[model samples]
Target: MSILVIGATGTIGSLITQRLADAGAEVKALVRQAGKREFPAIVTEVVADLTDVPSMRVALSSVRTLFLLNAVTPDEVTQALITLNLAREAGIERIVYLSVIHADRFTNVPHFTGKHTVERMIQSLEMPATILRPAYFMQNDRMVQQTIQDYSMYPMPIGSAGVSMIDARDIADVAVAELLRRDKASSALEPLTLELVGPQPLTGASAANIWSAALGREITYGGDDVAAFEGQLASYGPTWLAYDMRLMMTGIQRFGMQSTEGTVEKLQTLIGHPLRTYEDFVREAVAEG
Candidate 1:
């Protein structure tokens, strides 16, 4: 069966497209426009914008499985609802959604709350679905790569609180497996929520140390100053976006972010290998530079 992948150019979705292609699955990569050089040769690119109902309908046509990964936007919930409605109409069988870890609880975080809204709707659909709530992305730090390279500091507002941050590549792996194959049979599979996390959690100090060791340089945690961090982000983008991130980071520190519980086992069960360690991510990042 063919699978439709949305948000195909994003950090997580891009990898999902590649993984699905690599596994010899028929993949339809949905894009707003067809740029010949953008997608891999294996993918069949379909032009569809999330808000464009006709386009989304055309993309969902004849696809059994759908990988739903929408970006954080002011109209995120609206776009997701539109797509979900169309997917239902198209009679798609399964949907694999990428969401944030504990998005249901952190009502204060704007984007997290948005994902939770879409997640509840997806659950209500009469279809088999998997909602993956991945912890803070390890690659999120790459947003501040400038500060990391020039100042030798991990400037995320994670504070000293330990976060069970996950690599986005691992998140993509889970999506690919659930879409093409599964750890269990169809009769056994049902609506499931997997809090995808890395093998271990890390405090700000611990993460800085990992990068320091991996990069062979002295790095430091920039400490917990939500206002200052938001100001820095504001310098680059919308102030409200930065404010929303400040709220999420504040919620993380206020409500502890480190809890692997049964997720590592769940991930290992899905991907047929051990969970990826942050150390491995660090080494890979360093080597890529």
Candidate 2:
């Protein structure tokens, strides 16, 4: 049976969809509009909206596995709950949910709290699922890549305590593995949660240093000024989303986004390789620029 992939046009979701297709899995990409983006020829595109019940039911029908990833929006929780309910109604058993690391701890952050709420609902409903709580994504740096290149500064306000950032590629691989594991199982597998993190935590200064080395020029750490970051973000995006991101940064500054004990070894064992490093990501970004 096919696997339904929500948020398939997004950075991580696109990677997951392509990887699943490459692995010979039947993939149904749930896109809001058909032909909005291109996927492998083998992928079956399902035009559906998460908030639209009728469309979602068609998307969930006959899918053996579901990769549940939604963008951070005002009604993220609603969308997730609605989709999960539909999946359950459709008798779709296997699921892979992409939640953030420290989702429970960052209760003040709307997106984090929303994901935590979804996680709770998934567990309470006894859904056979894999909850992947990934740390800060290294790909997030792509947003500030131009700032680093043009201004010689790293501007994320990710603070001194540091964040264990994971690569989107690693996240996609792991999600694909978990989806297949449960989808092809002889029976319903037990629900599991995995903390996906990088090889090590990276402070703002350390990140700047990495970029400096990559660019062969001195780059400075733009200090933790989340207000400035929010102001800049608000210039281009919604004010509410900018403030929401500011709150998330504040939470990260207060309580570092580090991994739990043995999380690195556990993830390495699962993927059979060391997690990709921030330095490598920086170098590649620089090279591509």
Off by over 4 Å in 1: 182-189
lDDT of each: 0.83, 0.92
Off by over 4 Å in 2: none
TM-score of 2: 0.98
* TM-score against truth, every candidate: 0.94, 0.98
Q: After aligning candidate 2 to the native by TM-score, how far in Å is the CA of 115 from where it should be? A: 0.3
Clashes of 1: 0
Write candidate 2's Cα lDDT for 1-289 as tens digits: 8889998999999999999999899999999989999999999999999999999988888989999998999999999999999999999889999999999999999999999999999999999999999999999999999998899999999998879999999998889889989988988899999989998898899999999999999999999999999999999999989999999999989998988789888887887788899988888888898
**Steric clash pairs (candidate 2):** none
- Whole-structure CA lDDT of model 1: 0.83
Estimate the TM-score for candidate 1: 0.94
